[model samples]
Target: RSGEAAHSGSSGELVRVQSGHGHFVHLVYDTTPAHVISELRPSVWVRADRPGIQFLVRVVFPHVANPRTGKPVTRLLAGSTYTQQGSWQQLRVDDLPKLVQAAVRPMRSQLGSHIDVREPYLDRLVLNLYAGAGTTRIAIDDLDLPSAVAVGNATEMAGRAAQKRGPAESPARRRVELAGNVLQVDGQPFFPRMVEYQGESLNFLKGLGFNVVRLSGAPSDALLEEAKRAEMWLVCPPPVLKDEPADDAQDRPMVFDARYEPVLAWHFGQGLTSRNLEAVRRWVEQVRRADEDAARPLVCDPADDLAQYCRTINFGGILMLHRYLLGTSFEMADFGTWLRTRPRLGLAGMPVWATIETQYSRELCEQISLLSSGRAPEPAASLEQLQLMVQAALAAGVRGLCFASRSPLDAQDPATRARAMMLALINIELHAIRSWIAVGNVTPEIKAANTEGVNPGITGGVLQAGHARLLLPLWTGTGAQYVPDQLAGNLITFVVPGAPEDNTVYEVTVGGLRSLDRKRSVGGMHVVDDEFGPTSLVLLTNGIAVSAMNSGLPGAGQRAAQIERDLTAYRLARVQEIDRQLARVA
Candidate 1:
């Protein structure tokens, strides 16, 4: 309102700011049959530099009051659309703050539950609004605005950034591939922790079929050694701190008070600071000089200030937008807008990985694939959807996809739940690999030589569909007494409790099951009823069931197995058509 122009409303004369090249759109709706609250959407274009692209959108909720009382009535406020930069230009030192100020005003008005904000940097603004039964209005401008990037502009920019860094040996020599798929770090077809120096885990990973391993946060020399020996690629982030940060349990800080936020840790800030760029650059160089693999490039999770870091360093792998772009949140569109600037971020075809913390990402990806293919969810991970997502990502020209962590499983009490989490990871990884292969472009062999299919367990059967998608809850102490025996196509559930901290192992026994006739010794299938406290379950896959039995719990053993067996049989029966085809053809 400070910068305004005169305008005439039906009631009287009112002052409204000149929208400039910005246009306004309004979305009006209500939660109830008769929505009483009202909202407006304003779109403004501001020229910005550096990160590039400019367009500020604000959803304004005005205070509608009674004229006689001369007091406020209903409060209205929600989210805002941030202003972006002009293609290839950085925001002027002066213009940056004005754009930021415009974006934050509405958010501040409805603080607390109604208004929520996340300010990653001085120039970045994020507003979230939870509106109840209300009316909303929206408007979008630039319906016919010219596209910003020229056909060959990004290619030229990428060339310039690369030339500035001079020449490097190669990115592969520094590579280290972890064993198996997600959580199974050790066991057959996968080694636990690979050390190129010791080279144990790397060798195991080579057999399992992983081309690349991420040493993002706090990787040890052992990890590096494994990579060297396995001949698999490694993607590591530059060390932000000498040691792990104080809040190492989770790098994400929790905000008890939404209105007033706290500062990020020193390491997070340093990773984005100009002072640290040189160190990061030097680290990359050192890795390259040490061995051929070092040049493979290091990946960085520039969580807060990506633009600041990318402007300086020649990062090998740049995580563009963490959870959002990966479909972890409801911000896929915003993520796409941001990703359009990847060529500007200075890493062209260098691997770009997706990271997300919640289940939303996988769920959302499934949704996207379904929408694209007009399919509805049957159950569990779908090969069809995975294929679609992988195809879409590859078409977008991304180098690779990297999931968030192995830690999520570690946090479990070596119980049933922990085992379940590990199995989930394995399921996810398997789906991912299968999806990648479906595309027929980016092969899993980038990390291995002969890749029929990637092994995701210590020793598990070659993955086939129609398996009951079971839940493996990382077992906490207070459950049943014995683990369930499993047969082919049975789902197993386990849990890791909370965070990936507990390093416990649970053993279960499966008696009446046989691996399919075509496979080797029901690969790595074991259920040992060891008296190791409460029986815990770990390293589970989609086709097995953990009978509900341990200690202080309810039903155990045979009964649970009966239920699981019934469920597995039902699922396989549904896939009988495919089974018949395989039998006849094979």
Candidate 2:
């Protein structure tokens, strides 16, 4: 017999037994019955003395009490054979269910009655290790008995494994395709009318006529399932890592200890260390595995490195340019510069999305200060300011719009209520013309013909989608950080080269089509004055006149008849004023 220990066991003893032909060592542990019920297939790690050392490990259950009868039962709960020798090899009991069934079959046969062996109260676990010929020693340690819940969640474990590998593209289950500046689902042009706020259910969005929701991060499995049930598409932004290194002071790579914060903070400018790259790769894989139909866009500032990284990851070919924190003037200039210089970043073909802040100035400042070290200089844009931003982006050919607000929608204060109404109206209008907006080809910049005394901030553009042509004229408030009340009522004019064709009728309406004027064209170029308050507009087309009234406040929809009546009243008043001016001139 060799007294020298092969490996240290859990009992701090070197378990070595010698027999010319074969030998066995038995270790027993008294455990509560609940432990056995919790862990179905417990396992332990063992090491053999040398290669090709044949051994058998079994877990014996003794003094198990039958639930129906008070009799004790002895059975082999689990067992495994070790043919290969190595350091710390795991011995897992195979076919536990079959073994339990086999043990119960004989008990039933002897008693001549059906015996329920499912819930057996186990009293002890006897671990036995048997060595084959020429085997001298074995070492065992680290017994693990995991609960049934842990054992059943193999899918989550597989998802984690997939994260280690690069993200795999699943077969198109929902069939959402991005083809040349257009989004199509199931072969139909789909315009994503998306809400950016997070909510418990998508019922509110559906009520507002939105078809998609944009989330800052990946939604949970339960939320994704719920969205699928609600028939709404989701656009999930990739985790936006902080620009600085994980350890800003030491400039060391970030340690991904937190669940998702570290990974999300990985972005461009920061050198792509192995950890950062791994984190990004894992994030992509995790999102892909979570929901195949969800669109994943990288939320990043306009930068060459970020664009390159996005392209490398094969992201959903869309990059959201977030400029909401910056004031309106800066945002407009930044958007224009990025749109023009996108090709320089190797993002020529990718579409860029814009975010609209829906908070008041004070609230915006508070939120921005909290996010940064009190360095954010700009306040949040108001409802009209946000409208101007959206219109300008649209004129500059942005592909999508996201209304951003940190506050929840359930807030019923006056400001929040007004914001909700405005958002609802915007959504209604966007949903109505989403198909056209999604596929429209933008024309060159359209400037005011007579800017002699007009607001220099006025800008216009044209979008031609199929047979529908939309002329968008936007008037940004006077170049002031805080817009004056007088600036809200500026008048901007658009010059239509010629009137509509014989069969076409000129339909003019508000920004959200809240008001409408359906009238035959005069067949000549004419200048139309647009009241720049609330970002409303005049839409002229060959279709029936559909008008929407702004109500100035939120949540009000206008009927066609009401819009027609309002248009007549306003036009008549304007004509009378013009006549008075002409008479005074004479």
Candidate 3:
């Protein structure tokens, strides 16, 4: 709730807050450069009429406690630039700090010093409190910031200003790729929510030079049309999970049940309802008939419940799905073996993807490859398992290998999560990008082999038509911080701004790429040149950028834009190299 000051309100001298969803509040304030703000604690008092003391207040700021770093920032006091806390309990005057009491004193006591007036410019303050029944009071005894001054209604006013600032740009949307005749929507490699609003997503992507948007799940037809309209590519999957199970007489599991819920939720989340399934089937046919040249591929989920439905779901689209999660059990192995022996099942293609068992582990790499190859090694197998999977997938004449998220829920912040997801996507798509890198080079073939395998893979109908693809998802719900250190490789299924499961490729050229003084951004893919070597620049191509670039002289901003253009060209060259290698191997 907005920490506004109003006289004669209940819980006199205490900001009245309720308990429910969206219960958390935020406090925003300005600080002097020198004060070095730290631990701040605010007291929350309950109304005399309430059953018990109902509120606990604590300081909140943009900064978060860094456990890995040394001791947490300790400098703090009652009156800090920003302060917030959460609790279901109602607060009384005595429970609050002197600053809060003074601010609201007109409604209650008139005995103390007038509430310190925080500078209006510095007055932007917010007090975010989370309240609910049962557990009522929680207070922060300490925090850190500079020049503590509690301003009334300062938090809400500042929060509104911040909201107007809009969402932060994602790092994944920066790079541009000129794919053959068409451009790939190059922005954040893949985001789930983008599949729902494909048009706006693709337009946003294309506007920023993204070459492809991997259309996952059951995106609406309009979404696909938007991608096509934006001249972007899509990687689609079928909707087989929509069909009723063979045994309708059996009781269905709840949405939370791991066995059935994930798939059902995913299907439902994709907006695929029972009544609309037929309509979707027809649309799938239409997509196939209309754009044979750039039709998106149909990918599938490997969950057990979705097995037999693959055929029905595939709906004439290229079949792709992960192998590792399909199952690591002996029963799964036997079932896979039997299924492979079938003639009809053989008709469809299986593009394999490997996920890290944990974080970055050699065992994960090996196991992923092994599972992709069509062999079922021992469950809980390590790197050795990957080799077997890869071989099996290859033997089955599968399309190719996809590397998905490495650490899915690792990041706490939503923005940081978006960055991680983007990085992973970029890494996995290296094969595709490398293809374009090989173009225009005199000795392309030799370089290509060194990068992408001479042959990418073999598809049932068209070898290149249904080449292997990678899916990188930005997990939502993580707390996101606009940390510069994560901008580079933030594509690995991490987080994005507004789109819950989408990512935006950050433009590194335009913005002066900077990171936390001690930390480093994901540098796994940064190409360094000693002298005249590679450079990193953050780019922006939104309406603001276009307007700024066109009107401004060739000054600092223009130079940044130029750097963006140059860096994109350089990256594209590298990507072409990978593409050529895939073609060579293919």
Best by lDDT: 2
lDDT of 3 by residue, 41-76 (tens): 323322222122222233222222212121111212
Which candidate leads the pack in TM-score? 2
Model 1 has an lDDT value of 0.29
Compared with the true structure, what per-residue lDDT tens digits does model 2 show for residues 272-318?
43435555666555544433434433344333355555564455555
Q: Which stretches of candidate 2 lie over 4 Å from their true place?
A: 1-172, 237-304, 313-315, 325-344, 360-364, 367-381, 450-457, 484-493, 496-527, 530-556, 559-586
Q: Which ten residues in a row have the lowest lDDT in candidate 3?
A: 441-450
Which consecutive 10 residues in model 2 have the weakest lDDT in total? 261-270
TM-score of each: 0.28, 0.49, 0.23
Off-target runs (Cα >4 Å) in candidate 3 are 1-232, 237-297, 302-316, 323-429, 432-586
Scored by lDDT, model 2 comes in at 0.48
Per-model lDDT: 0.29, 0.48, 0.29
